[model samples]
Target: MSIAIIGPAEIEAMIDREVADYPTDTRAGAQTLEAFQNARRKPRLVSVNFSGGITQKCYSVTRPNGDYRVIYLPLAGYFSLCVESDFGPLDIGVHGPAIACFGSV
Candidate 1:
């Protein structure tokens, strides 16, 4: 099945809000924002997984702080965010589609 990314505007806006926590004038913050923008422009497809005949595509963006994974569940038309940190992967939350996708998945 072909994988499609959903809600680019919402995704970009959310990422922008998250990045806004850092002061724009700070070097680290600026670098982080730049990395995020670059990733949004050309996200790297990290993997494709199939479970119960359902396919999911994972795309990742490298940031100064951590890596962000955008997982697309095409069947459900849902997208979820996973952030990598020193501790481990944290589920930022699900975006796009609706909460019904969560129950079904």
Candidate 2:
């Protein structure tokens, strides 16, 4: 299979779709928010500098196969993923709730 590369606009759209999945009025939504808050309490996560003075949460996960980074912005209600690339850290459009982003690790 061939690889496909997407641009910033497409990434933004994916993030929008992921964030739209949960409604704040529902129990699932509440759980999502709680999960993010719980992640914030942990020290395993790292801090990254974001635009507009926002400190985004990040964690570098390593496995025998490869490595990837997870990012969370609680105020924005979303999470993202990044992988080390030949050029630099390449962000893959992985926007979603806390459990969906951080539960596996």
Candidate 3:
């Protein structure tokens, strides 16, 4: 699979769409916004899981809404941003790797 890099502008646009999808006042909507903001600050790789010999790095941030976890596949240039809210888990998965390469930044 080819990895496509995602730019900051594209990420912001995605967050804007997500925020628009729900009313800001609502808990779900608020959490979505919070998640986006937290992600905007600084995304860090918190852990690397090697379960069953399959490696997976979890990038995360802590927010008022909840803990946001980013599942980014450097090789595939794909990523999924998510948060656990009162309603459930809010997630955005995208496939795009511009500067596609493996390992942490």
The model with the greatest TM-score is 3
Better of 2 and 3 by lDDT: 2
- On the 0 to 100 scale, the lDDT of residue 98 in model 1 is 22
**Candidates sorted by TM-score, best first:** 3, 1, 2
Over the full model, what C-alpha lDDT does candidate 2 score relative to the true structure?
Answer: 0.46
Taken over the whole model, the C-alpha lDDT of each candidate is 0.45, 0.46, 0.42
C-alpha displacement of 7 in model 1, angstroms?
A: 3.3
- For residues 1-105, could you state the per-residue lDDT of candidate 1 as single tens digits? 774545545544544565556456978657655554554543344444342443344444332234554544334455555556554334455555221212122
> How well does each candidate superpose onto the true structure, as a TM-score?
0.33, 0.33, 0.36
lDDT of 2 at 46: 53
Give the poorly placed runs of model 3, Cα more than 4 Å off.
Answer: 7-13, 25-28, 31-40, 56-58, 61-70, 73-105
Mind sharing the TM-score for model 2? Answer: 0.33
TM-score for candidate 3, please give it.
0.36
Write the residue-wise lDDT of candidate 3 on 24-77 in tens digits.
787855765554555443334543333253445443322323444444444444
Q: Which pairs clash in model 2?
A: none
